[model samples]
Target: MAEFTSQGGILRGQDVVSILFPVAVIPLLFLLRSVFFYVKARSQFPGPPIRNFWVGNLDQTMANDVHEKWLQWNREYGPIFQTWNSPFSRVIYIGDPHIITEITTLNWPKSSAQYAGFRPLSGDALFVQTNHEKWRIQSKRLAPAFQPHVIQAQRPCLAKHLSNFVRAMDVVAEQNTVVDLSSLHILLTLDFVGDIAFGTNLHAISQGRDCRILQLFEIILPELMKCGLFPLRGRFPILQKTRLMYRAIAELRSMAEKAIKDARQKGDEALGTSPRKKISDILATQREPDESYTFSSKELCDNYIAFLVAGGDPTAHTMSFLIYQVLCHPLVLKKVRAEIDANIPFDTTVPSISQVNLPYLNMVIKETLRYSSPGFGTFRVCPVDTTIAGVTLPANTTLALWNPAVHRDPKLWDNADEFDPERWQSGQPKVRGSYFPFSSGPRSCIGQGLAMLEMTMTLATVFRRYDLSLESGFQMEYLPSFTLKPKNGLLVRAILRKF
Candidate 1:
């Protein structure tokens, strides 16, 4: 009886070990596999990372101002570094001009996962096209519409919007009330882009209120910045189908379709009406000269929405930064205002592009773009196994070209942190990849001319008519999102000039 009892106890012990073995081995196998992949992906490229086993460096990047985090990392790791997005995914950040020039000038395809968020809104638009050949053809067809002469035609529309913006500021100046200039810049840009893109005066500037589309964009942009950049919310498809996102997408689609329809119906009547050929007309009529390529109605809508979103956000943010930076430096403001006063006449409506010859004003704008570096960063992916900066990068690996790091590198620029507009006086100091606010090469921003025009025109108009001062106790912080925006808003007191 004693021997039989001992045998049963041994069997029971064996049973317990059997039950626990698989559970222990499963996680161990997963961990080993993860490590193997991580090691394989991160071969040779070095980074400064305090990494978590599961989330990698993602936790460190999830913050209010993540781009600043990138700047910090750049300082620690030098210009080129590898960062882990997940245990299995490696991202390389490159700031070297040679690498950047090679990637952009070669027209590298964008990583699908990295740019996936833009697709739901832009829908394979020119900026977000995954097909290299398609984008090339589309860019060619759309080139005429954005030529210097064509963009010049929009000056009247921009001038009209600036006039409205100035009048609105006059009210706040008279009241001696502090106004959120960031929000106002958004409103003004929305109105300007509205006229130029859809040929509609949205009156966002005149009313000083957020229109439905603008409100929808405000909601959509943050959601995208959250899920698209980090992808935590994107894990669940249900969250992507939220009502607010649905509404914004639907409304944007509707607006684009209507604009396209209107342009098609009106034809030359529509074409002749705008100060220049509007983006809507351009989209509606644009095709390959040989008719080999033409945008479908869906493509038209996508491109139009792209224009509205792209045309407004970065320009607005840059303008806001320009104003804020000038306000912060009283001497800079005095010089810029003096330049504007000397060049731009007090009652000049639709100031000719040539007429606004303020070299100092142009310097201020360029310097502001560099200081703010508002487009965030350009992302590209290696289409095939390739080498960049002497480091081997596997196919499909994401490469981040962060402008702020490049723009603020002390090695690249003397006193890089200091806001010096004089640095840009000699035709923006050719710095190769170092000074690319609009990015560079084939995939650079198409609406850059329009943005520059709007910013310079608005700056000249405002500085000529008003004296801007930062609100007391107001601290400016960078609100890094899809585009770098001013946190809260740039509150300022605008005192109308009697000149």
Candidate 2:
């Protein structure tokens, strides 16, 4: 016993270190393994510094000025840029249109679905799901609902709503107040989509804030963003067990289910005296495209919720920022206002979103999308071994690409960085392969037509009624997210036109 104690307990310093060193080395070993894979993969592409090790360069990109910064990267490194996931992971940034168009159109090796765990059940249902066959079928079936013929019918409704929007704006204008043009734009969009989706008229334009349901929607959606970014949580039992996260998800789910139930009753009330029926409300009642559990009413709920987001916020951001641009370029604003006055004539009334199909207004809307794109940092997982730009890519690689980076390529635009509406003035609508605001191909945004219509009408109506100028010295910039948003509010003074 004495010998055992002396030998075991009083072991030599070298022996003690030998035993302790391995334990110390274990964590380092694990870290090294992760780093090795990350570094090796990242070497194949071009990228910026990792910057902050905790979050990599993503923080810089995530800042309010991310759009400009990312575009700066494109200027710094031509088209393809390399990105790292902070201390680990590899990302490829592709901004060239030739490459973008080719990648989006190809029947290719498999593409990543990105819809892991609850993502498939979330607002990401249509875009995130990887199943090509199902996507083909579902998209085809759903296409009819958004066709020009059907969408045109809704234009009258949209026009009427825009009239309310103008009245609300005029009230703000009449007081000579520095209006929160940005917030108001969002309110208008929320009420518009709500009218169409759940038949809820929060009257956001008039009330100037969301209703209880909209507030709940905002709460639920911010939580939904958490799942969208990290879609694996539902399967990883521990993450699923996290009460706060799960509870928030539960709340969102409950809210969505309630919205669906409420949707059934909304159509009657929404037909004008109410906010009026949107195409989505009609779709919600009719047959679903697919009978699969994946596309059921529950799925419809998720898709509609997603649709509201995709439809509303981005367009709001676009219109608001475009207004900011109008402030910066008075000449452009004057041109637009003049066009509106000439075509749409101000009276005791205003034209609908469809009435102002002016050439220059179209250019402004298109340019706004190009300059400050709605979505940024879009990610897709590689489904199979594929080749991009002649470089072989292994299966299961996550790729994050930005449109602003590519759209700003000088090669794509003569003065890519400049805000020139003249590029689209001819009414020819010619776009280089690399200039995609609505992401290209079969997987492109489904609600693009609606968004375009919304922008055109909003621009036409507002410019027709009011001439906008910044509130004495406010310079605004872009806020980066999955989409580009405006930082600080768009505060502009509007002068009403009297016929």
Candidate 3:
């Protein structure tokens, strides 16, 4: 009787404890997680706190011009500072030369979460490739074709397309109507990129019609930028407009795949004795004995999309901004005009690399790139726990290097914000990381040589043939998207210059 009573009592006690244990531990676990995050935040790098526990700084910075916010914060908090992006994540913004040089040279993989926004369009392409090894392989394979000589090999093709561009502008000039230079430039760049990249003329300029792909590209950025910051964008039906953009991008992918197939079938026989290589041709012809070294058709499509994303906006916006800035400053325009008149022959279809000796022209372009950097910033993630800029960054921590902030830093140049092209001609030794319009180190823009050549040639071609002036009392305002664009667009009056 005594043993049975003892066993029964023990069983009842065990049941009571089991029921209470979880009740006590559930809240305890919640408390422990909160404590862990708090401790981590305090122990790791310093950063500004978010507005709330649930959303962090998303509420404050998500809707606004985020880059402008970064610039403001950069001004407020020295060269290196951190901001809580979410309860689970913190972002460290680095613009200091030493820190930027270190992170970029190390070629830190971009933070996967931050760059996930870029994936829907350019899947695993060079810009959105989260895997470092894969990125390295792709970058190396693509590097040789972007070299100056290789880019120059495409000059004749570029000149042919540019002549079409000039004819389009000439038609508008003949009408004597105010031209939206911004849209015109965007179309021109799209056609140029399409021709050079895919070996197809989109005919956006010559036909004076908007390419569906280009239109898709434009709307995608503004919506995607929002989607990138707000995860719940899909929950709202109105913002669901981005779905159409995705569908359009899918259609574009199909177009690219077809173009590649057609190009492969045709071969380089069209070029005959002298073959000029386009990016599409290079991609089609690339052969590797090892299966591992070869790129798949999908990979090629993704790469061409990356080219469009990177090349399309930056080129057009930079050119548009350059024209706006030049028109805003008369003396700057006169100096550039003088340089063009002296060096470039009036009827020269394409100034050969050696024939183009416009120092001031080069300087002006460099200064514009400095003054209005199209790529305002870049994202990098620390791969390993490392110290940078006198602070320790845990692995997977996201860092942003704000280029415009660095560009406009008063300490870096004399009157940095002033429109002064002569600063480059000052003969001062260049600061290494201070002005990287194309970025620097291993992963810098491979298309930079092509971009510079195109800009120089286009500027010489257009300004030599036409005199452009901004509409009277015109004002320029910027819209922050994937690239800084003129909010109102660039309106200009064009007159044929009698040489």
Strongest candidate by TM-score: 3
Q: Write model 3 residue lDDT over 1-499, tens digit each, in one string.
A: 1222355454455666777999999999998998797677655654456668766677655654665666566667666777665566666767687878887787877778767766777788887777889888899888766877788887777787778878777887899889888887788777877877776778887555557777777767766665544434533426456787677778888878887777765664553554647777777667687634256888888888778777878888888889998998999999888888888788876676765557888888889988887886667887677876677767777777768778877766788779888889766776667878887777788888888877888888877888998888889877777677778889898888885
Off by over 4 Å in 2: 1-36, 51-55, 86-88, 107-124, 213-253, 265-277, 288-295, 352-354, 427-431
lDDT winner between candidates 1 and 3 = 1
Report how far off residue 172 is in candidate 3 (Å). 2.5
lDDT (C-alpha, whole model) for all candidates: 0.77, 0.67, 0.75
Cα RMSD for predicted model 3:
3.7
Q: What RMSD value applies to candidate 2?
A: 5.8
- For candidate 1, the per-residue lDDT at 174 reads 94
User: Which of the two, 1 or 2, has more TM-score?
Assistant: 1
Among all windows of ten consecutive residues in candidate 2, which has the lowest summed lDDT? 107-116
Tell how far residue 60 is off in model 3, in angstroms: 4.7
Kindly report which residue stretches of model 3 are placed more than 4 angstroms away from their true locations once superposed: 1-16, 19-27, 35-49, 227-238, 268-276, 290-293
Q: Lowest summed lDDT over 10 consecutive residues: which window, candidate 1?
A: 1-10
Superposed Cα deviation of residue 295, candidate 1 (Å): 2.2
Clashing pairs in 2: 46-82, 47-82, 56-86, 97-434, 270-276
Native-to-model Cα distance after best TM-score fit, residue 293 in candidate 1, in Å: 9.3
lDDT tens digits by residue: candidate 2, 1-499? 1222363366666776788999999999998998887777667666777767766665554355656767788888767776554554445677766556666777332234234533633544566556777667767766766887666667766766777888778787899888888887878788777766655565777666535544554444433443334443344536433344456556656766776777655543554454323676656555535732324666677767667677887888889878887778878888887787778755625565446678888888888888777765355555677776676665676555568777677876778878888787565445455666776676778888888887887777777667677888788866554356666879888887666
